[model samples]
Structures are given as C-alpha cells and as structure tokens.
Target: MTTMNLPIISSCSVDGCSYNHDHDCHAGAITVTDAAGAACGTYVDASDKGGVDASGRVGACHRSDCTHNDHLECTASGVEVGAGADRADCLTFAPA
Candidate 1:
C-alpha cells in the first residue's frame, strides 16, 4: 500500500457534518476548497454519517491562496473544521 504523510484534522465543531463525531473528524482524508470561501470540500449534510475510527487527514487542498497551501497540499501542523459561510470550513486557512 502507498503511504501518505498528510496534515491531521485536529478538531471539528460542525456537528452536522457526516465526518464529524464528538467534535472530531473521523474521515480517512479530506479535501479543502475555496470555491466560494475557504471550506471543507469533503463535508456532507447532517443526515449523512460515516467515517473511519481514526482522525481525518488532509488529502488535498484547492485553496491556493491559503498560507498553508503548497502545490495543492496543506502544510499546516494541523487543521480545524467548523461551521462557516460555506457550511463547513477550514478554520486554519489564512491568506498567503
């Protein structure tokens, strides 16, 4: 199997997200996007609920303007997800 060293989702406050459980993220990986604002591209509706036991990691980041973005990858020590204007957002996102 291929190994990937990606940033972790340290915390999440969007209890309505499918990947959020007990204020933590359990998805295998997540994608950060900025289509409308810095947000979690992997977020799903509150009705959906499914994720792994372990915490989620950043698989890809499309917010090129984010300071932690490097070639579409997140370079932050860890990321936080929570409710935002886009529904779910990357709290760690900051402009470069």
Candidate 2:
C-alpha cells in the first residue's frame, strides 16, 4: 500500500483525552470541525490510564466550510490544539 505522509500534530493541551500523552496527541490522525464551539473532533474519553504509542496526524476535516479543508482533508502544514467547550479544539480552523 502507498503510504501517505500524515500531518503532524504540532501540540495538544487536552490532558483528559485518551490520545493525550505528555501533552501530545497519540492518535494516528485527527479530524477538525465545528462542534461544541471549535472542537478537536478527535478527542476520545480515556477509560484507561496510559495512551497509545502513535502520534496524531490531521486526517479528515469535516469543516467543508473551512478554507484549509480540501476533499475533507486538512491542507494546513500543522495544527495547534487548545481549549474549547469540549476541552480540546483544533485552533487552525477558519471559516471559508
């Protein structure tokens, strides 16, 4: 299979998320969109104590309304994670 260069998660501040380890996202990739006011869309509740070994990349962006969204994938080189109504959010989202 052809390997795609996944987008790098520049930073994450969601301490309570399941994919967060040492303030970094461990998901294979992340999705961004408008939900609960600027949400990460990838945040998952952690039922365990530790995180996975994988680092998160920007996979699909549901915000077809965002300028950075191309074919549902994020075109941004990097994305910043921060606080939102749901705790984690993709800060790079911008309305198109």
Q: If scored against the real structure, what TM-score would every candidate get?
A: 0.89, 0.80
Q: lDDT per model, in order?
A: 0.86, 0.75
Instruction: Count clashing residue pairs in model 1.
Output: 0
lDDT of 1 by residue, 1-96 (tens): 122579999999986888888888988999998776688988887677799989999999999998999988899989988877677899899889
Query: What is the lDDT for 25 in model 2?
Result: 84
Per lDDT, the best of the predicted structures is 1
Regions of model 1 farther than 4 Å from truth: 1-4
Measured with C-alpha atoms, the lDDT of residue 19 in candidate 1 is 88
True-structure RMSD for candidate 1: 2.0
